[model samples]
Target: MRFSREDLARVRLSAAPDPLWEVALSITKLYRPNVTEPYAEWAAWTRNVDDLRVRSAARVLGSLIPSRGYFPDFLTPADGSPSLEEGIDAVLRTPRRKLRANLGRLGRLPGWAQGLADGDPAALGSLGTAMRTYHDGMLKPHWERIRRRLEADRATTGAAMLTGGAEQVLSGLGPAVRWRDPVLEVDYPVDREVHLAGRGLLLVPSLFCHGTPVSLADDDLPPVLVYPIAPGRDWMRASAPERQLEALLGRTRSAVLRAITYGGTTSQIARRLRVSPASVSEHVGVLRGSGLLASRRQGRGVVHSLTGLGSSLVAGDDAPWPAVNSAQPEWCRPTPPPS
Candidate 1:
């Protein structure tokens, strides 16, 4: 394939941005909140475990998210009293190895895997806390900020969807964002930063303890922080339907269907997707065009509803949609392979 300078520019500019935090966000939002589906499923799996399973599951889930890879850190013996060193060794050696490798930061990992390969499992309880700290203290705060900004942007975007001023649309909203000098160490190359700067997304490294009753604690694992570079550019896309189904179904559309399964509208879908109403309208257009949705003009504007096809689309059916937009830089959808 031939590449344009602009295309290459965007490629060089690419880095996993803030929403990548969605992996952790999914876990926490599911399990941490009142029970969610995944959490309920996970809990169901753990319910039968004796104490040993409990600790092992905790250790494994701890290592899985930041690393976003699954390894069976839990599944060892909880013999009367497990050794802290043994637990640490099990996780440090097995799950931790998998985690580092996946993040592509394994070289930076402590050989503590081999060292703790023989350490205490009890220490692993603290290990979850440590890993959580790296993820939560580092990535989480930034995530909330980005999510909040994205959500707010969506509201204003929705309000202006009927109107046509990208400038006035944005201007009415004001600058709408402010980010202080990063509170974390970023590990990306300077060129990547340059790229991100242009794209309006920022990725930083979150290392060490900050904002507390006292001083910094020396014993904490530093987490890699990934967040929006342009904070505002989080809304850079009019419609990022890079994937085929996404182009057709739309983020807002998918959100709407999900809500429909639960029940939702353009306003509600916008609220859920953290996108603007106009963005929602754009998605609704795609869905309606694809015959996956039906819309009617009500008092002031359009009200959209899922068609029978939309119902199937939401039920995990993807074959009906054309794979036309896959090559469009602005569209995307990654439907999982059927089992």
Candidate 2:
């Protein structure tokens, strides 16, 4: 596939991240094993694990997302800062006529998705619930690391474009893309060309997209190119809080602490640990009281992250730490254990 740029001024770069897109693309790993190496450990760790809720969700969403071919563009919007609930609302609001047209174009959809065309409220609600369930189970645990990689990619891409030009940044996107003067070529199963006639383009970096960059099937929607970002070996290290913490706090609480290394809310922590939100809240309260965790209110929920004391304790305990303020010592940054 090729993207035609009438002029250098016609090209644009964006680094907005969305959770729904991650859910849509990451589900592909469940069915496509060949490209799962980078995520193989995570995939294996999550497979057959308890959490029947996420499993049911996977089946429902799996049908919506085939191994190939076009799915609904509305499912993965390019909103700058997207949340699961917001994405669900968008999906529910999709016009019946547009939903049927998109689904019919894909030949046959899953029963749940088909029910959506018939305006089944249950199916719509179920799909939304399933998506949240899946996100909580599969993606929330690794979100901190994922977010860091995406931020790094944005910084690098932005710097490249500033130091050089759009041509340099486009050529450096990944091995799957090429810049040939006025057109940007990408390796796609389907042959097509998108003319960015002053509309420019939205460059989205994804952790789940393996090789080919994905674009919307509809030309009318804002053009977006979702490409993959490689995670370093350090980022691939498994999450294991210090054995001492486990002994001190018990296994479940210890694992919860490790999952919140980069900080998360009660629902996110609960989803990651596969425990009840109330349980997580209780433990978080205990940890906060102990000065091992700090809570900040964001929107309707509180975001829990490690305080400096908490960071020092986790570092001493030998758990993975997220990035901290630059003023802090080197011990605060996440580093792989010495071999």
Most lDDT-accurate candidate: 2
TM-score, prediction 2: 0.69
lDDT of 1 by residue, 119-219 (tens): 44544444544544333433343343334344443444545534642223322322322222221122322211222222222112111111110101111
lDDT of 1 at 314: 53
Q: Number of clashes in every candidate structure?
A: 36, 0
Pairs of colliding residues, candidate 2: none
Candidate 2 lDDT at 195 equals 74
Worst 10-residue stretch by lDDT in candidate 1? 209-218
CA RMSD, predictions in order: 19.2, 11.3
Candidate 1 TM-score versus the reference: 0.24
